[model samples]
Target: MPISSLARSITGAGRRFPPPLARDPHAGCAKPDRNLPPDRTASVIHKPHILVVFGTRPEAIKMAPVVAALRARDGLDVSVAVTAQHRQLLDQVLAIFGIVPDVDLDLMQAGQSLDTLAARILTQFGATLDARRPDRILVHGDTLTSMVATLAAYFRQIPVGHVEAGLRSGNIYSPWPEEANRKVTGVIADLHFAPTPQAAAALRAENVPGAAIHVTGNTVIDALLAMRDRIAAQPALAAGLDPLAARFAGRRIVAVTSHRRENFGDGMAQVAAAIARIADRPDVGVIFPVHPNPAVRPVMEAALGSHPNVALIDPLDYPHFVRLMAMSVVMLTDSGGVQEEAPSLGKPVLVMRDTTERPEGVAAGTSQLVGTDPDTIVNRMFALLDDDAAYAAMAQAHNPYGDGQAAQRIARIVDDAHRR
Candidate 1:
């Protein structure tokens, strides 16, 4: 399908999807009703007051569509709260969407531990909940902010709407805290906004109430489309990217993004080696957006640092990343977001982790989950690099996660639920 055609189809379908429920945030927590079937329902008497909360860059990207949807409803009062967990990067996403937070906790500190980040979000979110007194809190994806914000909402008896909910790796430790975060959020969220059928199935197997779950697709595609539109509209950005686009016009561009805890030490070294090897080839140029984490920095710098073909730069803002993905030959990453994003761009992805929660991508034949071993990373990199048939097969596979417009669908669901 033509890129514009596919984008329009996804967005159009998304805007028409109906949401299952609209929850009131101030409603006190009720123990799961064991006697009622998941399909059991009650009529809504009022439009919900929603407070959307997030801290990291990914959460902001995904939540922007949901926030926009909530704001369109005349009766629903919407507010955005940022914990500022990642500080600068989080603000970048907010600014891109032109969203100003009603509350900014500013919890970021240099080199803060995961524990510290979670604790700070919990404490500040509790204070925000008490003061704002919104009827519902919306938290996106699986992050420290997602978990702590949900917990704080639960503690305050505020209902939670979990956007991009019900993702599971089966093994909690594979994605470290994230797999566990989504699992815990499931237990507390009154409204579950699942992005895919696979995610909905996972929630059902775990016995989460089906009445509470809505398959809203993903919001990242909405963010990407929004960014793409912005880039196309801005002559300066479009002009700036032209030279870079022209430089690698015909040669394949490999986009690499690695910043995972499991892949930090030896794994990062392996990825770096693979990047250096890929860079050595005249046909391949790597655009690596380096994450700011200290653990990932040295390994990335030491190995791929001096390579002429690899462009090692600071972590890119959303627009640049989207543009890069759109133009890439293939993607190599440990990030959960990229796994979903690449296929929308028709770019094959090699996941650097040992396992993935997004089996939809793999099942669709767009992604390969290669572990962090040096040999495996190098082998797969070359599989797509050297083998024309393999590269074409992976690149042309259908995207299971989305075509785009995930955000628009999510917004429609929230808006319709409110209307009902």
Candidate 2:
């Protein structure tokens, strides 16, 4: 799909899309055979049902590996449900991973308030639970979907598993509800699949039982490694970047992305200014995939749209984004997933937020926090772009995240959780 049409497919804006994967009533699990004896059918129906739920693009990316891992196991039935908090972007990842959501809430509105979105997920997902009756459900990260889904599962007395749990920025409102979201999930989740040791420790500090906490490295690395290998084998999978590679042949490319709600107006403006200033250098080119959010796209376009060296394009599919990260000298973003992903590719990430729940990167010399202040963003990014020594220090391909087996570990843990 062309980039323009990809953006509009979520809204049906001037584009006709074949419907997404059809909803399957039995989901990834099999329907019990009615022809068989009643005793045998009951046994088949009791084969532990695991439901994987997520809403946004990041959640989809991280959970895809877990879903794949679970499906590969014997005697375990896995189903996927996407609430689609971020409609088209989430679809892009699902297509890349070949994930067919058993239930798509289809709950995105043009301009819905957080309270409204939460209410819809709570009620709709509650209905899905009533029908699916999963043995245990898995939710990823700190989205509102995960939080309310956990609440719904708790009300129904179903066990919940949290992937990428135990991250804390110390200040709840700094990440603007995400910090709170993850903490609340940690409280309710019987299985906490933390991405790092620090994250596991945070959960312990919160009085969570250590037995429940397992440091399964971030699944983003699993997803990243898998795509990176695919791009390596075929190379055509990531051919979307061929044009950009030709456009900025000799110049150093700086891949950029930002869509954090905290950095809406002024914060976005600062990031744009920094990009424009970086683009001023003839040797450096900025390739920013402008986010489709109303608050983000306008600010960035108004500030840096006319810049000659900058390519402000629509968001790329998973392989293209990974290809961009592999091609870039440095990554600039406020995305939590990027913080974990870029490092595995040996790309130093300059975060645009004041605080990050994933602080493992900073301590591991893989990423740096350079808030949204244009000066800070520019100066910090320049250090990596200009100084080879500085760049090499942060460019260590040693990822503290994971070794691409997180999903397997998570699958094993989930299997154990139900076996008991």
Score every model by TM-score: 0.86, 0.92
Each model's RMSD to truth, in Å?
A: 9.4, 6.8
- Once all C-alphas are superposed, what RMSD does model 2 give against the true structure? 6.8
Instruction: Tell me the spans in candidate 1 whose CA falls farther than 4 Å from its real position.
Output: 1-47, 238-250, 415-420
Best by lDDT: 2
Residue 232 of model 2: what lDDT? 92
C-alpha local distance difference test of each model: 0.76, 0.86
Tens-digit lDDT string for candidate 1 (70-155)? 77755566778898888877766776678988888999899889998888888888887777666667888888888999888777
Candidate 2 per-residue lDDT, tens place, 1-420, comes to 112333232221001112122234364567877898987776666678889999998898899999999999876888899899899889889998999888999999989999999999999999988877787889998999999999888878778889998989999887988988888887888889989999999888888888888999999999999999998997878776677789999999999999998998888888889989999999988888888899998888788878888888888888888889999999999999999999888899999999988888998899899999989988898888879999998997478999999999999998986776
Q: Least lDDT summed over 10 consecutive residues: which range in candidate 2?
A: 11-20
What's the CA error at residue 377 for candidate 2, in Å? Answer: 1.2
Candidate 1, pairs of clashing residues: 14-409, 25-135, 25-136, 26-135
List residue ranges in candidate 2 displaced over 4 A: 1-28, 33-43
